[model samples]
Target: MKLWKSRSGVAAWLVASLVFVSACSGSGGGGKASGGAESPPASSAGSASQEKQSQEAAPADPLGKYDPPIEITTVRIVNDTYKYAEGDTIDNNVWTRSIQEKLGITVKNNWVVSGDAPGGQGEQKMNVSIASGDLPDFIPVNSRQLKQLVEADLLMDLTDVYEQYASPFTKEIMNQDGPNALASATFDGKLMAIPNTGSSMDGTFMIWVRSDWLQKLNLPEPKTMDDVFAISEAFTTRDPDGNGKPDTIGISLNKDLYGGYAGLEGFMNGFHAYPRQWIKDESGQLVFGSIQPEMKQALAKLQEMYKKGEIDREFGVKDQGKAAEFAAAGRVGMHFGQMWNPLWPLVDNKKNDGSAQWQSYPLVSVDDKTAQPRVNLAVGTYYAVLKKANNPEALLKIINLFVETGWGESTTPDNYAEHFTKDGVERHKYIPFQAWPARKNLDIHLHLLEAANTGDKSKLNPEEQDNERQISEYLSGKEGAELGWAYERVFGKDGSFKVVDKYVSDNLILPNEFYGAPTPTMVEKDATLQKMELEVFSKIIMGDPIDNFDKFVSDWKKLGGDAITAEVNEWHASK
Candidate 1:
């Protein structure tokens, strides 16, 4: 009954029926939770091909039960924080039981890794599987790995299975954000994988500055690139920590440049230099952002800041976690990161130093042109079936059941509690196909904002109701206010969602032009290229010659960069 408009808002109101549309919206720095999800977009029922390769499966049903039942193997990623009730596990839990009981699908895990983050155990195990060609029946992979599998001719073409078997609800949820999710997984117009979609718009970056430091130094907030530098200088030199030892850093950064916290992506965006993004050129051709001439300008600015002792010298060696220690110790004043940053390292600042008040501001441009935050296609995980598997359509049915249980008519209170989460346990994690619409978190933000304004708690669900209570407690200065600071900064008035609205209104969130899976040359050479880029950029920021960037651009092109660009353009042209 509500219509919201934004970058990732529901493009069609018809898809909003009978759904709570809430969960995991904030794409935080690291471990960005499915930019929290709700329902999906409309479904497309037709495809180029639909192959029948089931060993023992009936015609596709939106919630059809399997007669004999089939077992599908998969690998999973879970973090240490995951909690489960007694007698429940990643294998024998409510969701796995539901898949078997409802759909007659026995969900089996070939391997389960502990950490779910990039470069964690999950990815390592997956890489080993890719190398050995030993992937399970139902596969969970990233875009790059998906490309590798497709190139190796290992994945089943779900083109027909998804179209014919996916329920209207499942279809809508998958494509809710846009065609990019499906488009990304399409290989030569074949839907080779199911994109576990997240919201790219939620991953947009902003500057998280220490407002206390700003007020203490009598500095104006950054509206332009100059203001950013001036604030950094003032923070570094003025002893804003009030300890008079010149022990503070103006800006903080991690060893990895693109980290979610203490990252430099926002800083580069200010200069209109979108590193790690493939953006469009004036002629509408796709070009890599790091190689653009504008990148040199951003690098030059960072080099200047480094020379002036405004940036941390150890930043070149510190990771995001290590860089955050400077904030907790109140030695750094400003940095660029995602909206969920307050939950992590920044929250530590509030607890450690009572005067440390941080706020997020839109990234200011170096020039008159607005600096748009660039984010990659937000489909973090892809579920695929091996072409050799007997039950391809079974995956689709399982996915449909998951969707039905979450948002469809089956979404009763008992289903939401027992199957989804009970006693703070993420029961849904045990499900094979975990997905939601990109608009879910934004919807939560809108409803929370409206409730704050009108005292109307009628529209909020149980999850949203609890969130409102936490935010209310934070705002009312109740006990344990520090615990609610993250919620308040995220959901309260003038929260990060308000900023998300502004970016959408201004149309300033620049998404990467290349959303399709990695190209052939990209699969072969992207790793080397990314490493070279990070090292070169780090050296330049650490006072390397500015002209070194030109050399990097030349070298990057020579070393398969040219090939990758041609393949990217080829993919783009074909699209």
Candidate 2:
């Protein structure tokens, strides 16, 4: 097979990155950093190197260290999963120290906030900071917040600095997914923020199934919507778990119906419904997906499934984490999720039950029409330099180093262990200024697939090489080898990436039509409408009349959705 070229990202659709910069101008004086934020430098052993950097003049050396060094304060949204080495903190990790040693940059966090999810403490604290008009030198914000910052004129336009300071390899990584990522960061022809480009085309949802259970139940693999529904029924009622009890669940789903895991996007796609997307109608007008007739039909099928005891009655209260527990316990036989999900709840289930064997399949169509899963791989996090920061180019330099260490010619295996990660610890995320090559993971999958076929893995990068080793051990069936099967499921011949290949090769991707900033009407009303839609959908799925969908459609239009559609189309026209 020819190699695939693309990247993927974490649960971008699931993670809410809510930010809003107020009209208040940046105080210019930095905010009070938690823990006084004093120490962010290379170890004293590098003092001579620091002195050497201090003696040199600033140059456009893509990886050049600053003369005399420079300090840039920023805030961070620390994830729950972040674990540091001893004597290290979020602002003083391997990444921070590497920046000090290699770039002569001292990066400190103005304040550390907990959790990166939307409406989490990090989002709330950032909102308060925005309201207080205290921002760090270079701050990361989401698309929603970037739009407001652009309107407030509180951010530096990075067009010139990016063009001048970015290395050729860095530029290649930034635009790896073509111009869409950069275009998303651009406003009024100026690049206001450096987009942390992510995977979109490679990020579509697929149906993950308990393949062993299918074999146990004497069932065929799924090819159409009928087969999917049939499998759900058999898994739910046929004691697929062999417990002689009707306890196995048909499908696993989270309360938030659209995410990388346990979401209904793949299920919705079965009926030609693309929720949370903007698609051009036959009339050539951009239309919202949630309110379409297609969505209602899909919802009706889900409602029917819920009524048939295939779905959990109280799913509205369960988040993805909680929903993952059911799958981990081996009660769930199928799900709709992104490609990375096998490494998560599915792996847990496999580890829990050695007999468990889950696999991903392309989302199938309900009729003669092909299924097209909606995907939004747009850049979510953007690093914007403060309008009054001392060094805007520092952001570019840091990103350059970040990219170089991970993907550029300067990269070595040591770079991955030293600055990017350490023994699976994702220290690369702790860096204040960071961006990823958009197609890195997809490239890994392709490389591994080719290596698996040819048995020649010399050209594989560090990450791909590690995955190859894990897959080898798993296939060897060594002690505790099954744990590595998650990697196998993602990169092996039968892995989820193979399903991704099929979906892309067969041209079944339904890319989001709208990727611009939230239109004015959407800014004001989108959240409320989304809330209403979810509540209505949950109600209908849990025994409420299906006609409620009709009411929801009417109310959505009346409550600013029509206006938002108009604004969206206007932006589309401008594009």
lDDT of each: 0.74, 0.74
Model 1 misplacement above 4 A: 1-61, 68-70, 75-83, 110-136, 148-155, 387-391, 404-414
lDDT of 2 by residue, 45-110 (tens): 211233224324533455666667888889989876677888889978888887887777898888
How much lDDT does candidate 1 score? 0.74
Once fitted onto the true fold, the runs of candidate 2 whose alpha carbons sit more than 4 angstroms away are: 1-59
Pairs of residues at least 3 apart in sequence or in different chains that clash in candidate 2: 6-439, 7-439, 16-118, 54-68, 200-377
Per-candidate clash tally:
12, 5
Q: What's the distance in Å from true for residue 349, model 2?
A: 2.0
The most accurate candidate by TM-score is: 2
Which window of 10 residues has the lowest lDDT sum in candidate 2? 18-27
Q: TM-score for each prediction? A: 0.84, 0.85
